[model samples]
Target: MARLTALAGGLAVALVLLAAPAMAHNHPSGITDLVTPAVVRVEATAHVDITLLDHIGELVHVERSYDVPIGSGTGIVINPEGGIVTLTRVVKTDRDVAVYAANRVFAEHHKVKIPADFARHKLKDDVLNHHLQECYPPKTPTATCIINVTTNITVFPNVSPADPKGLKADLVKAGDTLDSPAVLTLSGRVLGSLGMPTAPLADKVPDAAGSPTNVAGFLGRPAPNLPFTVDIAHLRQGGGGDSQGRQFADPEKKVDEPVKLGKLIDEGFLGAPVIGDKDGHVVGMLFGGGQDGRMIGVREITAALAKAGVAPRRGAIDSAFEAALTRYHTKYYTEAASGFQRVLELYPGNVVAAGLLKISLQKRGTAEDAGTKGAVSPTPRSLPLWPFIVAAAVLLVAALVGAFLLWRRRAPEERVEEPPAPVATASPQQPFDEGANPTVVVRRSQPFQVVPRQQPLMTANEQPSVKYCTECGMRLGPAHRFCGYCGHPIET
Candidate 1:
């Protein structure tokens, strides 16, 4: 049993040693990649349809329709059910699209001079001026034009092959301010089943100034050619929970932070999520643009989501991606590759996982990979002594255990117990004749006793007995030649 136990222990150690090389290469990249997959591009437009009434020279009716671009920016998916958070300005515009459509229609049909813009303009002619004035706002009993407007929102996810048509979403809730957070829900039923990757929202903004963070979002339509971008920045002091929002700056001042982030916002980072460097959770969102760029803290973001009645949560796809990401950052490229592949199976078109998978495959067996180190051919100088020493020690322990078990098994057989010898007793016989020699009965344990032939013998029916010492009267055995107690001699 002990030998079996030792062998089992040695086997376990050997297995662990063999597995060490495979696990040695793991190094984790910080939390940046965790939020990238959930970022998406948001585009909104106001579709306007207008009909103009021309009655001055002739009774003529003209109709026109136009799609005016509202705004475009970035947003983060906050739940598996396709809930999203972005700036209100992305989906809800402040400008009057109806007025812009009315201006263009009047200019084209009436041949009237007017700036085709969102601003209301008066005409030189009295009748046309009166008509245009009526079309400016607040529909009343004396209206001259008919207009209708609808807002259309589309979300392009960071995925492979690119979602060309994009997912349709409706504004669930909008914040009080334009730069504040607005919530949207994807329209289709399939979005809930897709297990979309989601960004985790931090409970509140970091209190300390100069907290590190990453701002990740798409610079263009999500595609292989235009992958999402991530930029590092630090939070500046002040504007913790105010409409003014927070500022970003470089502690080292090596780079002009406001200028740099301004360029990013102008390029397409508007409404991007600001991820906290400490834990990789979203601390705020990139708001505003140009030299006046700022961030909206998580406290306001959650308030908007709460108004929308959508709970922010993670899903299974996140589980798989995080597992793969850990292996990837640890430099376990071979194992990392397999893990990423599993993530893609769970959530296809995952841009982050696909990118990491490609890199993992490339680096799996390279010299930098720790997993491949032990498998490489070794030279005399490159060979290590620890492995050999460990093997020798393991063999020595096994031998000792086996020897002990063998000794224990054979101990009982080697110890032999002798049976008690048969006790000898004297039988009645004719006494020795005529004093030739008096036969003496002796025992090993006692003195001998002698009887003369001239003396009378006992009858045949008498009970037989052993001898005793003549002087000491002590009991004796048949082998005794002298009394044990008295030292008396006896003839044999």
Candidate 2:
């Protein structure tokens, strides 16, 4: 019976254990879903070349180029303006610039030619007139018709010169020579000339903490124009002052330790952007260095461009771009590609968006030019409580049924009774019972007596008797307390 009861109890425990995992799976936390859309891969066409220097400190321009295959990083699209703020270093290096658009079209640096016309004026002089001695066609001997070609001519033939459009033109003129600018094409409008600059964090538009940010870039070498997503774990406060007045963290810090952006998005995302998900505004650009990811703030981007005399205006490419990004996060890759293409159609220089759009298209198992369905706002996944409640109810019913069955089975067992044992009487003994019930024969125990042994005292001529403990050879007192050596009591 005991074995049967133990078996039933074990079976009941096993049933409860089997149902726990199902309950937990139905109710996942909300944080898991929130981060899916905010992550992105950053792609950079890294034109890496090594410049060897001569002993005299002059640049020994090695007549060779080390154009490393295109690199990648993660970045965020902060605002609706087509301005995709990423690390300046990513697009600012001494390499040719190319931004892949959503339509799978790589927008490269196309040298444009503008027609220019100039007029040159000059004077022509006739030194001496030669005499026509023979006289050709019937004319007076003194009369002479002189034909002369003037030295003034307006040269208006088609003249086209390749000149960088924006701030770069200002820097590389006759008087001042400046670095080439990073440029992006948005909706056929040139967005920038020099690379984006870094500014102070306090100067940027306020962004709340815990706001969702996305990053897109490259990890290693990606196939030509492939795009991917990067995971952004978190962001923290970081900045420092130096001897060069107030130097903000951006391109300069990239060569040093990996900064905050580097910590979150490391080597692969050398120049990705940290963008605010709320409005798709680029908040920070990634820099590769430091244990943690490093990035420069958006304010720095605006300030740097401003210093170069380039005013960045918000474009219409942001909404569609974000919509596509949202689709990609939701695993709606097909729709995402379409959204990215739409953004590219409006803004050409959005490299990050263009790269991702192409990837989203590829993920959907479709070609880059394939049509996709329109996207609607997704319904948030709700906590599933009914399944857990039903499971609990079933468990409670099973336990109650088990208890009822057990009680019923125990009720059928019969009770048993046992008879009590009889007491025995003792026989009486006959003695002087005739007189007074015979004074019961009494018996008494005798007291024990011990014999004492006596020892003779030593005379003056003989040595006094001395007692010693057998255990440790210590002397004992005549009245003998306990032996000091082994704590044995001595007889008096």
Candidate 3:
């Protein structure tokens, strides 16, 4: 039980150590990679189909179609089901596409010089100029041109092997302002059942000014040669207001932060997600361009998503990726490899996963791979014989010592049995009985004096036969020197 407890304690410590590296760092070391996979390039095009009516000696009907690119920017996937969040200006344009289409159509059909622009144009001919004015808007029956305009929004994801055609998406919700958050839903087929990778949105913006952040997006269509760009910046004070939008701060003045972001915004990062340095989550979206660049906070993004009836959430791909990331950072390459492989199977061409998986595969089973170390064996080990040997020796010694003690305890109580004592007979001896008889003379002389002399008598009870103990007054055998009942000595 003691060994088991120690083993458990060691395992707990190992787990804590393994998880430490991922939790220790608060800065954005490489966290920008976390959001780059979900970044996508958004392009909006205006499709116009126009019909021109030219009345002349011969009535000719001319129909033509024109594709005009109105807007291009970056966006982020918010959910696994292909829900996207971007700026309204990236998918919706305010220009009069109808007029642009009419201008091109008229120029081609009439073989006349007409500036192909959104503004209304005039012709020297009164009738043609009148027709062009009528084509502007609010269709009238007398108008000489019929035009229909539609916008097509396409999304190119950051994946390998570059999807040349890109996925089709439709605007689901748009904010009040051109730079406000807009929601788009993919109309194309999903890449996988688990859907695409999504960027995590922070619960709230960092309250302090000069908060560090990274802006990630594609400056062009996502491709093998064209990688997503990530730029570091700091947030200015007082973000997310009706008019103040959010501004970038350059404390050191080493670089014009706004101008730097503005240049990227102009290229394609207009709606790029601004990732927070603290936790690598989307705190806001980049907005505006040129000398003054701004951002829209996550609150506005969520609000727009709410209005679109969509919830921002993660999916299976994210779940697998995060699990793998922990193992990778902990140097458990064997386990990490399997986890990364699972992620790749779920979503192929995942750049981060691919890179980590490659490293994991190389490091797996090596000494540094923690997952491969300290593995429990299935077979039980054979215990050493020395302990049992020592135990047996101790038991034998104890038995011998116990036996010797038992013999010593009984030694004093054992006494020898003595032989019986011999009985004694009383006898009298005669004096001078060896010589011849010559003593009769004296006897005659003395006989006359036989006067009355008293003789003492003896009784039968006076015979000397038995002995008694002086201490207890108990009878004793004739040969006994000590009393059997009281252990008293007898004097002869």
Ranking by lDDT: 1, 3, 2
The better-scoring model by lDDT among 1 and 2 is 1
Stretches of candidate 1 exceeding 4 Å from the true structure: 1-29, 189-193, 238-240, 372-492
Candidate 1's TM-score reads 0.70
Compose the digit string of candidate 2's lDDT tens values, residues 1-492.
444555555665665556444333231222222221222333333332222222224323322222333333432322222223344343333322211110011001111121111111111222111212111112344422212111110101000121123111111111011111122222233233322211112234323333345555545333343334444433333343111111123333333223444544555565454545444445555554555554456666555555544455433443455456566655567777778787656645455555577678566743322233332322243234455556656665666677777878875453222222222232232111122111111122324332232443434665545686676565553434455334555554
Give each model a TM-score: 0.70, 0.31, 0.70
Q: Residues 192-291, candidate 3, lDDT per residue (tens digit)?
A: 7789999888998887888889999888988778888888999888765756788898777788999999999999999999999888899999889987
Local distance difference test, each candidate: 0.78, 0.37, 0.78
Show the lowest summed lDDT stretch of 10 residues, model 3.
Answer: 433-442
What's the residue-level lDDT of 129 in candidate 2?
13
Residue-by-residue lDDT tens digits, candidate 1, 1-492: 566666756775775566465445333334778888899999999988777776778777778899999989899999998999999988888899988988898888778789888998988898888888776666777766788888999999888879899999999998888888999999864332556899988888776778778889888888778888888888897674567889988888887777788788888888999998777889999887877678999888888898889999999989878878877776668888999999888888888899899999998988645457654643322345467557757776777778778889987766533333223333546342233223343444455544432333556775644676677666554545665444565445
